[model samples]
Target: MRADRLVSLVLLLRRRGRLSATTLARELEVSTRTVLRDIEALSAAGVPVYAERGRHGGFELLPGFRTELTGLNHDEALALLVAGSRRGAQVFGLGSALASAMLKVVDALPESYRDTAAGAVERLLIDPETDLLSRRLDAEDLPDTIVGEVRRAVFAGHKLRIHYEAVGQAPKWRTVDPIGLVTVREQGYLLAARSGADRTYRLSRILAAEELAEPAQRPDRVDLGRAWQERSVQFRTGGDPVTVVVRVNPNRREELVGTAVALLAEEADADGWLRLTVTFQDSRHAEWALWQLSTNAEALSPQGLRAGLRDRATAIASRYATP
Candidate 1:
């Protein structure tokens, strides 16, 4: 770990030219004293690192001094390249930074492996805007300023005031104690609380945000996964849940079940259909999910949902009937 820190110190200086011990400590998640010690170790290894004194002074690598110290193997290099291709970093406002870092990694790679690895990565594709079904999966656009403030608040443990537009609701301003920021399926969410009650805000839905001077009222360290899971469970069960029994084509079973909040039971029939007891947040949710499967799935029970679908189909048929 010490060795890794030393190499990282050299790279940080090489890239940024100069950075104070305090800044380095913050970036490396260490201490100013630890950073000073690492600098000593790097210089002892003849790395041509020097320190400048004074308030604005910091550590820097000698002009034109570059190190071939990335030490990333072929598989690792490929993995980084693939990750760059996904453009996931763009969501966090790090697209340009990720690109620059990838270029540096490539330049630091061994010459013989570099060309082969670069060529191999060209054959791989990830997160294309349109999938095989021609369905577009583009991510929602978020203002850099809003994401920046929200991110700063979460990391700095500060409260944030946000102007948010919840679904079917008017825009309103609220102050929240941010717990964490999470991105799932390219959608960003800010998990926070208002007045100590758990609340989750979609980052894209936030029109504006400002980090507050007051520190957030939250745990010093949060188990984000557990918190998110607890919130997810609450959300899944908080609403009026509707359960339905459906017979789905075996081939489309996953398509049907994937949209359900939970699967209570399942059984396969000799006729090649699967019977599933599925729960959804409500009647509208249940109807919408099964409607996506068209005729492949039949809602067996809960005549209300069946009637809703029938009415919807009739409305569509009337639009084209003998027209």
Candidate 2:
């Protein structure tokens, strides 16, 4: 606990620049007395930690005292730099600060490790291209303070209160137990358990978030990784499965069935035409499938889907008809 407190204290000082004993105790979840003792230990270790006693006074790192990172080989140093550079703009906030801290760490390393570190850097080149910039998430627009708090709560198994906006409604406040953070196409989403149900919330929809006083309760058994996978939009649920059959010419059978109709089961006839059967949840899905296989395949079963397709075709043809 002391070591943890020391580490946290150091990070807090580095991040906030200063903190009162009360604030440090609250953040570290320890007593003020404990904070004082830890400060003493840090000072003893040549950390140059100092405290001020006044209305506006608190603990601060002495000016010109730097915490250097030592013990890294060249490869490790290079790897760290490369990883930091690859993080892009998000790092500008947290990543840049961390990279700066790492530089201090690298400076403390012995001369013997410099070559190893240099070798590691030479072994790999990191090029975070400008074109890929669009792929990075825009964390700048998000609340800087709460984003990190929400992340901590999620990882620490705590609950959160969020003001969220759905597609067609004004933003409303909701309480959810944090589960996981999902990154999709460079957007950050929070997979949370709603207060009264087993549903997840998206972080992008969250207008604001704060941690709750009560600790989070874990499920009897949790498979967070599996739950994340099952929540993907591609996972199907609750639909009447209808089978559709299609006929394709032999010459284009391989191209059509292999690429376009591979999801369906196919059978080839002696005349070089292929008959294919596929099951879909709804008429719309079937229609979409037909559109993709247009001209290459013809519907052979489920008269309803065929009729709908025909109706759509008529409507499309009528649109271009001469007056």
TM-scores of all candidate predictions against the true structure: 0.75, 0.51
Residue-level lDDT of model 2, residues 73-189, one tens digit each, is 455567675675554334222555776866775677677876577566666755433345455434334555656777877777888888889889999988888877765444566
* Position 215, candidate 2: lDDT: 76
Clashing pairs in 1: none
* Residues 64-177, model 1: lDDT tens digits: 987688577788799989988875677766677889989988998899879988998999998788889998776968888888888889889999999999999999999999
User: Which parts of model 1 are misplaced by more than 4 Å?
Assistant: 1-69
Give the least accurate 10-residue stretch of model 1, judged by summed lDDT.
86-95
> What local lDDT does model 1 show for residue 293?
96
